[model samples]
Target: MKPTFIKKGIGFAIASVIAGGSYAETTESPVSKNQQPNVVLIFVDDIGYADMGFQNLRDDIVTPNMDKVAKDGVVFSAGYVTGSVCGPSRAGLVTGRYQQRFGYHDNIGPRVRDKNVEQGLDLSVKTFGNYFQDAGYTTGYIGKSHDGDDKKFWPHNRGFDEFYGFNNGAADYFISGRNVENSEESAHSSIHRNDEVIENFDGYLTDIFGDESVDFIDRHKDSPFFLYVPFNASHGPMQAKHSDLQKFAHISDPLRRKSVAMTYNMDVNVGKIVNKLEQHELMENTMIIFMSDNGGKPDNNGSINSPLRSTKGTTWEGGIRVPFAISYRGHVPANQVIDDPVVSLDILPTTLAIAGIEEKEEWELEGVNLMPRMTGKVDKLESRYLYWLTAARSAIRDENWKLVVPNIHVQNPRYELYKISEDISESNDLSSQYPEQVERLKTEFERWNEYNEDSRWGWNKDRYPYTNGWRGRE
Candidate 1:
């Protein structure tokens, strides 16, 4: 059964009584000659394009603090996640490649028993943490951690020097309970600080992450740091402090009201960290990038994916498209918005570029350095065929045209093509009118898939189509 209004209201109240809010950060500006600028990646779960103030979301929702970052940095109007869901999307972000390329498309198995014995990032793959650590940066990860379910695959094992957050996708604000159920059978949904479970946290989860981030900076002020702040806010089993909910009580939709409150809390925490950066005079040297793991789960809350069709768990614009912004005072320009298409896979390369790391010609990385585009060194980003595929569907988008083949398991699936520019919501299908364009895209997708291997999902020719299964989607 769906959550009722009264149930949600009571949940909010319980969350409030247990979760308080108090935050503080470092004040000294410590810069080292050999140290690179501090990197802060604020990754919010299940937020949508219309959730932020700059996005002109429903006027009822408030996100002024996040708007401050957009006002001070370049906001990418057309930013996208690697996948529409959290696990694979995060895997792609961490590895700088499509997760399907490595067979990590599914969530990690439960903590108790391995339903499928799924593995976290293969030790073979390199993570952003590995790169940053190799470059001498002190890596710290705080808040929701979903990349791995097993303690062996924790953030500390994935290249982060200091890890303080839950191991699953979502945890309770104060109680630190695993709010969302994982597909894995034995996984326990609980909170942890380092390797130990947290019996009690003094404040809300969002506030805890922000305060920990500040402390991480204070301890590593003399050195370069990479801080990954992944908040469990706005993702369900909806919970937020009462003060935040009271601010949005006028909203009639109980789900949406809770969403607004959670988002407001996230924004306030963002403001807290940004203020810390300024106080330490490290704002100029800090490179902060804010993005969501995927599109919002509309059913879960008021996470809006307006002007775009569908929601989380589908291969639609609303499912993959998300709000993305980058801020580095004196480095990235203020108030610039890049509407061109970009993906989460590009973050690793971009961050490396910012930290003065250059890739060898033979490195074989998929993402390009976005610094040129962000710094006005280039006119625009290079265009390439962006592809999406899932067990049930497959799609390819180039420029304004997109081709979707739903129910791919069938022998003769109907292909529907649409001009996305003319129909941003994907309300129309024009496949019959443009057979040539459809064939061209289909052929391109086939060609790309031919050279790749289905590393994420073991090849199951009986269950999946495609000659070898190296396609972007399984």
Candidate 2:
């Protein structure tokens, strides 16, 4: 269920967290004279591309802090997550590798307990905490850790020095509890600190995550730290604070109002985190990454992935593409926009660079250091084929063209092609019109697909609410 290889740095021993224990750093390099910058990776769940004020898609969407992330730094207009759903997407983001490389092609579900198949990420796979912890930085995870069901795959043992989030995303945002089921759903809905369950909390979960993140920054202000705050806001369960709800009373739709409220509350928390950084004078030295784990599920979360066709759990622009921005004051160029396609996997490598650590060949990382592209050192990002796979569905993006392979079982089953540069909504399928392009992309996808394996724990049909056509019911 795990690999045997160790990622070794050229002249240093890379940090590796033993099964459920800590491994002392073999060679602790002296803290750099320049003081390595801190990293705060804020990951939102099920967010829509057009939901942010920066996207200017909706008049009602209110995300001022998120908009500031774009205004202060760079926004990857063609940003994407590795998976269309949470579990698989996180597997790729955390490990900095495509989830399919290790048979983690779907969201971890009820079948996680199956003895015949292991549903968690392979233990040997290095994560965000591992790299930073090895580099002498304090690491903390403040929100959902949906990597795996097994405790070994949880944040405590995944190299994070401090873990304060729940094991799943279904947990109530408020400790007061929502309509979470009394059975299986409840099991993954409880909040925990480290490995212990915390039965009490003062405020909303998003606020709690923010409070912890701010405190973490304060506690580690003297040293470089990597704080990953994967907020479970605006996801599911449809609950929000009364204060935020009242602000969105102008919106008549009750459900959407709740979502907007939740999102607004989340925006305030982000503002809190940013304020703390500024207070510590760390704003100019820290790298802040804000993005969604995957596209929104409009029906599920009242999210609006406007102008982009399809929703979560499908191979469409709306499912995989997301709102992504990075703010590293005095480092990355200011107020810039990069239209080239980039993925969540790149965050790990970019943060590593911010902390003065370079990727090693043995690490087998799929992401590249984005500094050159963002700093205008390079004319464009090096070309690469970005791919996505889940069960029978797989898609590959090569340059501006995208080819989506339908599950042969779908009615009128055929290959779908779109010049994403022009067809942002994925409304035009030109597979027939561009047969040669389709075949070329198909061949490239096949070659890349050879390295991937089947999902270790089978699939999660819950996420596949969409049908096999252009739209859900089409």
Candidate 3:
């Protein structure tokens, strides 16, 4: 059954309860003298590299809020997520480690009867929320929580104080339903405020999340808070409000029009949160990081990841590279563009550094602290190798060179290499010319893979097999 849209008054305090197990209240620990800055991590789902105006890809696509974030802070041209898919990328962001290290190699499937094969993040690993909550910061999670489903894997259990979102991967924008009875029609119908289900919601899902985020910031203005807003905009089941759709009627392609509307709506909501921060005078000390969970799935939705090769679900630039920015009013430089490679895993360590929390060896974070580079304390970041692996393919970017090895399971596996710096679109293959470099990168990937555990769930090859005409473009 399609859930009804209840047009209740906006800004109603979202009801909540303790989830998972009980924990000490926020009042239990007083604010530290260090004065940790509030952290807002805004994650947009499946947005393309060229989708926003900040990237200067298309003048038609309006993303004022996102563009403002890039203009006010440092923009990373080579920013990447650990995985090309949603679940694994989110896992890496929350844990600051390669999802592969914890056996999350692919997107988790719908809930199943097998206890051992439950599709969620591993329980033993600690998340960023755990670190922040322990250090006297109130952690609140809004929007999508694709990490897990079991009580133990719930956001509350993983250290979030408040959670207002669904546990599934995707949800419909206009109507709400039950569970993942069907991926498209009924996915994410069941919304939750903490552990309780929210049967009927008033506005669009994007607007509801934005309003809730503003309310959270307003409520927690006294103390430092960590707000994780993972907007499920521009993902699948591409539905947009009639008003938003009207704004982009110029887009002739139906799918493309819907994608633009969805992206635009998310931007407007982001503006709401930013406005609230300014209204509460939290902009100065707050650190805002905006990024996509993964590259756009142009095949699924008509998102344009132009000037990059292929689209989501492949180990190409379009699949991994995403629009990334960090905004801290006085701390980070304004309108600076960084070409150095950085990964989603870096969010944890960087946030900890900003919060004045010392990094401990036990945390085992794989990402680097980007403060020095962003603040001009260091002129250049030391070269580092970034990696991405899925069931069908694997890639490693060392310095400017990138090597992609398609799965041997696929017939006629291809090992292609590109000098990514010179060929941003990955047009030319240098594997035949630089066999030694390919071998070196392959060896490095193997060494890194040695520490990774076997995948908890294998890839679903049959799931999204259609190509959206934008593959292999130079």
lDDT of all predictions: 0.73, 0.78, 0.80
TM-score of each candidate structure, all chains considered together: 0.85, 0.87, 0.87
* TM-score of model 1 (CA atoms): 0.85
Clashes (N, CA, C under 3 Å) per candidate: 6, 0, 1
Q: Per-residue CA lDDT of candidate 1, range 46-90, in tens?
A: 997678766754676567666766767788776887677787788
Predictions ranked by TM-score, top down? Answer: 2, 3, 1
Candidate 3 achieves a global lDDT of 0.80
Report the Cα lDDT for candidate 1.
Answer: 0.73
Winner on lDDT between 2 and 3 is: 3
Q: Which lDDT tens digits does candidate 3 get at residues 1-474?
A: 111221121111111211211121222223344567999999999999888767776655777776776778988888899989888889999999998898888876542223356557888888999999999999999998886546577787898999988776787676544333332343344577887777654678898898999899878987999999999998988989998889788888899999988998888888888877776667778899999988888768888887788888888999999988899998898878888888998899999999988889988899999999999999888988999888678999977799987673577768899888767788788899889998999899899999997666543334333322211211
